[model samples]
Target: MAAAARLFRDAADPDSVKMADIAQAAGAGKGTVFRHFSDRTGLLKALVVEETRQLREQVLHGPPPLGPGAPAEERLPALLSALLDLKLNQRALMLALERAGAGSPYLNPTYDLWHSEVAGMLSGVHGDAAADYLAHALLAAVRGDLVEHLTGQGADPDELHEGLRRLCGSVLAHRADGTV
Candidate 1:
């Protein structure tokens, strides 16, 4: 997985980095790689899961503003910021994952987990009425393709982060005032 990640990170076009390339880099047999990952899509999914493992652990078990203990207002922005950073730093791998024909990201267990976490936090601010839809909307703002497009257009990372922070703040403040 580390070998695959390095290749993905280094490749100009992650989709062009084939299974054989990964196997060769890892000094493993092509058959072994294929047997383990099944295909490119599966391999890409595995890589994404591996890459996101640390963030998932931190969100689930670490300290405030990311884990369980912080107020929703704080945690929500922290989570979105972390996600945006992930999308920015892992742009190549993310774009490759989306292009891998793995089907809708909405169908992925990881997406469901993130959505549930966000919606649960949102519920604390807005009740259950708009939490689910709002969670989806907030997440859509950090979608990989959108991030890539924005960055490709020379959007500053700091501006993106600030925009996300503002978006979260607006959502929470509006809900608090019963204006959402």
Candidate 2:
């Protein structure tokens, strides 16, 4: 698994990754890789699931700013930032998984987790309806492809983070007239 991870991370093109490559990199037979992972998509999904578990742990039990100790205002942006980091790191694997599934990303359980969390936070600051819509919109803004596109066009990390901060603020803010 470690060898497969290294190969995936170092690959110039994720679409070119194959079970044979993973098997050779792991110093094992092709049958061994197949027996463990079934296929390329399965192997890539395993990698993503492993990475997601750590993020879940941080949100579920890790310290403040990201966990439970911070206010909603602080936590919402923090959560988005953490998610952006994850998407940034796993862009290749995620892209492979999406291609293999060839379905709506909304159907993915990870999207549900993020949507639920963001909606909950937004609900506290705004209303239920706006929260629901804004949560999905905000998640869209930080999508892997969008981030990749922005960076490829020369936007820096700080610029992206700042954009996220402003986005969260606008979504969470109430109108000056005391209305949504």
Candidate 3:
């Protein structure tokens, strides 16, 4: 996995990095790599899962603002910020995973988990009626493709983070103003 991560990180086009290359880099046989991962898509997913395990742990069990105890207003922004940071830092790996014939990201189990978390927090601020769709919209703002495009176009990471912060603030403020 570390070998694959390095190759993907250095890859100009991650899809172009073949399974054989990964096997060679890992000092393992192609058959061994295939046996362990099933396919390139599986390998990409495994890398993402490994990379995000720490964040998942924080969201599941850490202290306030990211974990369970914070108010929705705080937790929502923290969660989105964390996700945005992850996407920014893991841009290559994420792009690879998203384009890995894994189907619509909305249908992904990871997406569902994030959506559920976002919607749950949004419900506390905006009521259950709007939470589901609002969560989807908010998540869309951080889509891997969109992030990649923006960064490719020279959008700074700090600028993206600030934009997301404003977006979250606006959404929460709308609730305070009784607009949604």
Best by lDDT: 1
lDDT winner between candidates 1 and 2: 1
lDDT per residue (tens digit) for residues 1-180 in model 1: 888999888877766788898999999999999999888878888887888888888889999989999998899899999999998888888778777664556766677878999999988778887899999999999988999889889999999999999999888888745776
* TM-score, one value per model: 0.92, 0.84, 0.90
What TM-score quantifies how close candidate 1 is to the native fold? 0.92
What lDDT is reached at residue 26 by model 2? 84
lDDT of each: 0.86, 0.77, 0.86
lDDT of 2 at 15: 78
Clashing residue pair totals per candidate (backbone < 3 A): 0, 0, 0
Q: After superposition, how far is residue 139 of candidate 1 from its true place, in Å?
A: 1.0
Give the distance in Å from residue 93's predicted Cα in candidate 3 to where it truly belongs: 0.8
lDDT of 3 by residue, 61-170 (tens): 99989999898778988999999988887878888888877545676667788899999988877788799999999998888889989999999988988998889888
- lDDT for 50 in candidate 1 is 85
- The better-scoring model by TM-score among 1 and 2 is 1
How are the candidates ranked when ordered by TM-score, highest leading? 1, 3, 2
TM-score of 3: 0.90
Candidate 2: C-alpha RMSD to true structure equals 2.6
